[model samples]
Target: MDPKTALPLNTSRNMPILGLGTWQLKDDTAGTIAAALELGYRLIDTAVDYGTQPGIGEGIRRSGVERSDFYLVTKVEETDDAYEATRAYLGELGLDYADLMLIHRPPSSGPGEDLWRGLIKAKEDGLTRDIGVSNYSTDRIDRLIDATGEVPAVNQIEWSPFGYSDDMLRYGREKNMVIQAYSPLTRGKRLDDTTLGEIAGKHGKSPAQVLIRWNLQRGTAAVPKANQRAHLEENIDVFDFELSEDDMARLDGLNERFSSLGRLPYA
Candidate 1:
């Protein structure tokens, strides 16, 4: 698969099917990002809570890649003054606008109408090219659409064979929302699973590569985190092989609603 291959959005934007996730990457954020950029990563996922925005921006500059060559994503706090928070994060990123911005999670009360509205407002003002949500249930996603008269272009969630369900996958397909998979490697917890190991051996690939290929073959975007050059290369080297139908089915059977993030209210 092309490293830059992307899925179409409800808006006039397109998102790369693969991205580099920046959770807990603050210490060497700039160096890591700059290296990944050189390694052909176009989509870079970060959040305000990650506290790596400044380093990410510096990495983009340090890479000497044109701003237009990259697709940037960031998330906002649910309780944040959404629009203003997004704007401030943009300043921290040293970018005029983000390619995508998402509500980190649905707030505890109400339907998060205000948060959605603020994100929409940010998009309208060109603070972001697109707006979406993360860790949202199907009903919560519907509520946002019903309230805003606009469907999110992407719904990001913790997705892996172990953490995702077929129903959620189908729902995203029905809604035409690209389901961006985070923690697709399950934070290295499931890499040692027997099923993953068997499949990896057959493909002469690492379990991590097998997991990522599963996501790409399923048509959802994946953002796997890797800080070292070798790990980054290994993560992106998954495009060379295709998983068979039987392999896909075997992996799908591993779903157990498990999440490394613990029990999410929406999950």
Candidate 2:
């Protein structure tokens, strides 16, 4: 496996760094996912709320790839009965175990700890190989670890050139948690940024590609969503090229306080 292309999930195994995000890739999700698999995308990101689990499973089946070869991930949305609800929902996906599972959002209720404990149990029961949390604040992660005596294997957050959070990233690293970036493209807000455009010009790549490479260089696993076939292919074609130290520094200078989507503190 490619060293830069893989990430270690706790002490278990390495997961692919680039994954196909299925946030809004419905309707033709199965076909698209199948195409992505054929095109060599081994990591897939989905959520129970995405309503495409069945299609994802169908795509995986049709791809003719061994289940063990893919790194499958899904998230459980915050709900009053997140434990039982997530258990039932994942059961419907028909997978024996997921490579990674995360709480979609930090729970507002006091039972957030209970939900995490349930996920830990799921890991022990072989329902998931690794368990994590998404959109969690630094305080929340510290508190949970204190409460459960377990640190999350990963922490998925909205990260991009414009929305980089040094504090959260530092904390995750301090806890030995993998930081997975969900919107590494900044939702296309910085596609036309002058700095990225210049970097792309020098490298003969797209601005999006440059941004994705920036994420990789920063040591964060990124999953950028694209429903179009060409876009999907373009997103994963980032591995062939390498960014220079100067180029990386230029891109690093593009970091702003928050995403163009506005800052929403972790709940």
> For all candidates, what are the clash counts?
0, 0
For candidate 2, write residues 1-267 as lDDT tens digits. Answer: 232378776757776888888887885888988998988888899997788788888888889889788888888777735456556756766677888888888877742787788888878887888889888888888788889998888888888767667788777677778888887888887799888888898888999898888877777888888889889889888877879999987776666666645774542
**What clash count does candidate 2 reach?**
0
Q: Against the true structure, whose lDDT is highest? A: 1
Local distance difference test scores for all models: 0.91, 0.80
lDDT of 1 by residue, 1-267 (tens): 789898998777799999999998866999999999999999999998888899999999999999889999999897899999998999999999999999988888966889999999999998999999899998999999999898889988999999786777888888888899999999998899999999999999999999999999999999999987888999999889999999999999998888888854356
The estimated TM-scores of all candidates read: 0.98, 0.93
Model 1 spans > 4 angstroms off = none
- Against the true structure, whose TM-score is highest? 1
Kindly report which residue pairs in candidate 2 clash with one another.
Answer: none
Worst 10 residues of 1 by lDDT: 258-267
